[model samples]
Target: MTLRACGLIIFRKLHEVSAAAVGDNIEYLLLQTSYGTHHWTPPKGHVDPGEDDLQTALRETQEEAGLDASQFTILEGFKKELNYTVKGKPKTVIYWLAKMKDNSAEIRLSSEHQAFRWLALNEACKLAGYKDMQTTFREAQQFLCSQA
Candidate 1:
């Protein structure tokens, strides 16, 4: 059986930045896991039985990053699914792009993650350290820029 997970690629747009420079002003939220390789990624977790994908994404985002549904707006038409293998098991992760309503909102981390950072696309890609994840960040940046 494939391991399924869901999460949100949460980001914040800096105020006062012009639309032409929107990409530079956007920042993505990444969390450093406390376990395993201590790798950095968006907040995600295995889906609980009986939970739908979006529900799991919302629940995990709240549980892992302390940002509830009310704190961010989910951007429609930007969901991304990634397929990869972990420990010889097939895994699939679904991610939706969300924009933070309040850029200054505090991020309270759960024990699962040791640290968190809001980084630009390049820095986020570096910390993420996965080709697929880096591609996702680039796609997201382009999507946001197109909307701007």
Candidate 2:
């Protein structure tokens, strides 16, 4: 059976500087895992047996990043699913875009992650490192821009 996980592509809007810099005003959140290769990723984890994907995403986001549902708004129209192989097993991960309600909300990290950063799209993509993850961040940027 394939491994399934879910997460939120959490982002925040910076204070307006200029209309032309809309894209530059958004930043994404990434967490550096403490295990394995210590790669950075959005808050995510394996789904529990009885939990739905979105529930898992919310729960994991709270557990991993300490941002609860009240702290962010889930963007209704955007979601991404990625399929890949990990340790010879097929894995599927789903992500929904969320916008932080307050840019200054404190993040309390769980032991699963060692560090966290809120970064611009290019910086987030570079820190994420994987091609597919980079593509996901780019797509999220497009979605947010289109909505703007």
Candidate 2 achieves a global lDDT of 0.96
> What is the RMSD, in Å, between candidate 2 and the native fold over all Cα?
1.0
Question: Cα RMSD (Å) per model?
Answer: 0.7, 1.0
User: lDDT tens string, model 2, 51-148?
Assistant: 99999999999999999999999998999999999999999999999999999899999999999999999999999999999999999998888877
TM-score, every prediction: 0.98, 0.97
Which runs of model 1 end up more than 4 angstroms from their true locations? none
Residues 1-148, candidate 1, lDDT per residue (tens digit)?
A: 9999999999998876778999999999999999999999998999999999999999999999999999999998899999999999999999999999999999999999999999999999999999999999999999999998
Give the deviation of candidate 1 from the true structure as CA RMSD.
Answer: 0.7
Q: Pick the candidate with the highest TM-score.
A: 1
> Given candidate 2, what's the lDDT at residue 112?
98
Q: C-alpha displacement of 21 in model 2, angstroms?
A: 1.9
